[model samples]
Target chain A: MVSKDELKKLAGLARVELPDSEIDSFRKDIESVLDYVRQIQEVAVGDISEQPQGVYGLMKNRMRTDENPHPGGEFSEEILNQAPQKEGRHFRVKKIL
Target chain B: MSINLEKLTITSAHRHLSNGDFSVEELVGACFKNIEDKNPKLNAFLEVFGDWKEEVKKAQKLFNEGGATELTGIPLAIKDNILIKGKIASAGSKILENYRAVYDATAIAKLKKHQSIFIGRSNMDEFAMGSSTENSAYGPSKNPIDPERVPGGSSGGSAVAVSMGGALASLGSETGGSVRQPAAFCGLLGLKPTYGRISRYGLIALGSSLDQIGPFAKSVADLEIVFNAIKGEDSFDATTLSEPGGLVLPKKLVVGIPRDLLSNPGINQEVIENFEKSVEKLTDLGFEIRDISLPNAAHSLAVYYIIMPAEVSSNLARFDGVRYGFHKTGDDLIDEYVKTRSSGFGREPRRRIILGTYVLSTGYYDAFYNKANLMRNLIIADFEKVFESGVHLVATPTTPTEAFKLGEKANDPLAMYMSDLLTAPANVAGIPAISIPSGFSKNNLPLGLQFIAPAFREDVLFSASRKFLDE
Candidate 1:
């Protein structure tokens, strides 16, 4: 079972706030999920080999053209337009100092 | 002319469009008309596109120029996760509620070349985190088959859009059973192609290794057409298969049924009975049915839960308040991230993120993430071992049971996670799997029998599904 402190740590680690109201409920659900999936830890894999994951395991060294595909700043405006706060060309964040 | 949208298949639509039975505008208009009527009731589409008229003009031009592909003027629902340039793709979350796509997803680009019309962005479980659309930030999409029950998700709304005649076919993504389960519930064919088969360039990533954009349609050929259109190595997606290779075909089509994995009490008896009938059908169609052993098969869902969330945690780390989307002012910068994310994301997304962080955290990584990856390696090897024994495909019920009531498993995270029991194995192995609507349950809810093939062997799934459906 996930403890309250552990749950808070997880939330902090994941960069999401664990509001006081949601802590207990999130803990209960996450604990249940962890307990369920923890069965994998006991699945004796002594006889098995851990192959590298995915397409890269089977095939590699694939390459593409070196030339840049898109023009510089082609989507800079479109991307910047979505920023919550932005200057002319930079995404503006609150002052750090 | 009113289009019988429910019965319209891509092949039929193409013939009719070529024969001048109806104009592209009429087809697109009829789709809009149906969506307008159904979406309000079903809560299927999150947002309908407004520029379908422009797409109609392009399709008509293709037709007039005698260069029309089979998909020209075909209206399709795109899952909210796929980015279509100049349109909003929320992925059924409030954080990105107003996040407009600046570029088209590779699948959308391919479909656009064939002049395919995107009807709208359909709803889904936020961040593709849950089995039911109840976790959607907007709302859950009601099942067209039975309004009270869930249309299996996170591709639920895409299935509903197709089932309710909003679109002739739709595109969905699968990390677990997202696409196939909903397709099963909606009485449609759905496919989860080999991972990397479809480019992930524009898909909102959940589990990067497990996620693959797939299609849902009423007919097998339609599903195949959609798959062929979107699948191929992409320069943008590094994981896509490098070589265009021929599908592995056996001299005699042999299907392996791992009976051990299906014996769980969680699997409904009705699903088992229907699966037996499908086996008989496969036998009748000249497939050699063999009972086989996949030692690591039962560990699929457990392995998937560990692996998927880890990737989700990493993949979703980019959603800070500064760049785009909903932002919240907090005490400081770090506080800003915590507040924006906690407020922006829904309960389910937060829970998964926490769990992913937990598993990937230093102390627990060896127990959970490492074992899960090793178990995944074993699962992959088991499938390879079976195919080596001359078993061309693996068979199982697409889901454990028929679609359940809207909130049946809402309170129980464990029960909801069980939805992916059968389908998760394919995703784990990065193989091709298709869900064919086998028959209906006792309550008249639809059921699907799935056939999973070796990596890049979607050809086997397509031909087998066609024969099974007798299309």
Candidate 2:
């Protein structure tokens, strides 16, 4: 089982607040999922290149001229309206420090 | 109940509208009437658009002007995840409850050009996280076919919209089984095209790699029309592929059935029987069928769970409180992110984010995420090998069983994940797959038979699905 401390740390990294009540259950859930996925370890990877699958075949490099101008935003006003706290065109955030 | 809109398919509706048998207004009225009567019981639509008439007016002008596409004036329910500019796209989560879209999804933009009317934003599993719509912050969408049961999700409400005739078809997004599972349970045709087959811009990302916008309709013909309209490359989504040239299926196509995978003990006997019957029907239709083994298929679900959440965490990181979406104030910016997200996301998404963070976190990255990526290769290789050996399509049951009761698997995350087992492999392999309505189970609930083709082979899926429907 993943320790409760580990779950808390994970929740912090994920930017989610894990209530004390959910720590045990989350640990159990994470552990079981890890257990299920552990089957991947059974297959010997050998000297095979670790470049991952499904990425290369689906994507290809399609370069565009750098000189081309980016599409100017027509949605700034609408987007700003959705922000919970905004001043003028900029979204307002709490102090970083 | 005055009109049986449920019996009307888009093909027949188009013919009627074109022949001047009924006006677009009448068609739209009939759909709204169905929504008024059925949506109360079904909970399919989160909010039915009041501006449907105005949109249809434009479509009617197109018809008056002449040379209208087949989808002109077709009413479609948009899944909450797919954006329609200036509309609420909550993605069934509290985080996005009041968040309106600033731009249209590529699919929505394309459909608008065809004069398709947006009926409403349909409900879904929060952030497309759960297999059942029970995870929606709003509430579960009831199955139109069986009100007591769930409409399999995260495309549950979109499926219900079509099933109840609330819309002729719906645009639903899928990361794994969201579109197909719901279509199977609701007895509609659902198609998940190849990964890059459709642009993902304006879609609320679940797993960037696995997600694709798909269509759910009453017939394969309607599915094809909708797909043609919404598919192709977009400047916004770099991952999208340019239109693959059209394909023609061979006269005698050989379909492979991964016998070992289908024979898993978890699959209900009724589902197995229905799947076998579907295979037999295909054989009788003059298609060749063979028992094939996907040796690495067993690890697909595990790999999917790993990769999906990892990508999901990364993709969803954009939803911080500052830019847009739900916000909560705290002493510091870090606390604000934590509180806002914790409050905004529902149980399932929160769980996934944490799980995702764990897998991609330092010290564990190589073990979980890397291993899973490597396994994805083996799984893809298995499909490539099968397709190389004369397999035109791979067939399976869309799900292990028909729709279960709402809340049946809610508490058990593992059980909920199992609901997507058969459907996830196609997304993993980045292939096009469709779920076509098969015979019903003993419980009288609908079932679906799934067919997967090689990447960009949507034509093969369409042909096979159409042929199966004909049979």
lDDT of 2 by residue, B359-415 (tens): 999988998898888888888888989999999999999999899998798888888
**Which candidate has the highest DockQ of all?**
1
TM-scores of the candidates are 0.98, 0.97
Model 1: docking quality category: medium
What candidate 1 gets wrong by more than 4 Å, as runs, is A53-56, A59-71, B243-248
On a 0 to 100 scale, what is the lDDT of residue B349 in model 2?
A: 90
Q: Which residue pairs collide in model 1, if any?
A: none
Worst 10 residues of 1 chain B by lDDT: B242-251
Minimal lDDT window, size 10, model 2 chain B? B1-10
* Model 2: DockQ vs. true structure: 0.67
* Pairs clashing within candidate 2: none
Error of 1 at B460 (Å): 0.4
Model 2 bad stretches (over 4 Å): A46-49, A52-55, A67-74, B1-3
